[model samples]
Target: GKGGAEAGAIGNISIYDVDFVPLLDAAGQPVDPNPVGHGLTEIDHLTHNVFRGRMKEWSEFYERFFNFREVRYFDIEGKLTGLKSKAMTSPCGKIRIPINESS
Candidate 1:
């Protein structure tokens, strides 16, 4: 009952430690790394979409429950649509989630 529909679309949050197994050749040998690539180390941020009127509520929820503080606010306007967003980050600054709502 902890992370049921009460949590909305963000049902549950789980972090896992993943081991990356290298790509192997036909002979069971690891292939060489990409010459022009710098591999990804970790994720920096994520974005979540909410209903137009619920952005502030979700932002407050993240601040209260996850220790995420508001870092930035954006109001984007296009020719046909507009949106508002609030960026929230964890204390360590490694995680960020931007809550967006279309207007």
Candidate 2:
């Protein structure tokens, strides 16, 4: 799996599936139902770093396979570095992924 030690040795990012289980205390009782607090429900979005000049390719792939649509574009520049990003979201608006490329 991507989260295994072998994968970790090669890169910092690991892609894998997770099943959520209730948190428990020493007494085995479930911990706070809202562990994240502040009324946060679920992960709203995720970001991916893409190879420079491949943003268009990725955007097309997501749009073709996942029915995602490009919603926004961002260009952030700083003293030493800059990046380009495009945000895409699923048809239902529940999933959002922003692909980025650094300059």
Candidate 3:
């Protein structure tokens, strides 16, 4: 992009892929810190590990610590590995954590 293109957010900073792109105004003054596409939206989900047969314990931890509540459950068996998953989200429904036990 001639005016510079943007990549996804790394934390709150928007990444510009080009090597030499200036985020300056006509007088060479600094522009917005968040130059578009610059902030993390509500966290969709976070993936984590749980020992096999321990999904319940981990799920309970979220419920107790963050006051998260279970919103989804999944159990899938693939040819090579089997997995059990539980999705927990904060009371505001913004932060989500999906814990998985795979074998």
Pairs in steric clash, model 2: none
Report the error of model 3 at residue 40, Å. Answer: 2.7
Model 2 lDDT tens row, 27-65: 999778655646757788999999899999999999999
For each candidate in turn, the TM-score is 0.61, 0.61, 0.59
TM-score of 3: 0.59
In the range 18-95, model 3's lDDT, one tens digit per residue, is 434557889999777666887776667889897888888988888988899988898898999898888888999888
Candidate 3 has its poorest 10 consecutive residues by lDDT at: 12-21
Question: Where in model 3 is the C-alpha error above 4 Å?
Answer: 1-37
Candidate order by TM-score, highest to lowest? Answer: 2, 1, 3
Model 2 misplaced stretches (Cα beyond 4 Å): 1-41
Using lDDT as the measure, the top candidate is 2
Residue 83: error of model 3 in Å? 0.6
lDDT of each: 0.82, 0.84, 0.80
- lDDT (Cα, tens digit) per residue for candidate 1, span 1-103: 2424243333344222112357788999987768456678789788999998999899999889989999999999999999999999999999999999998
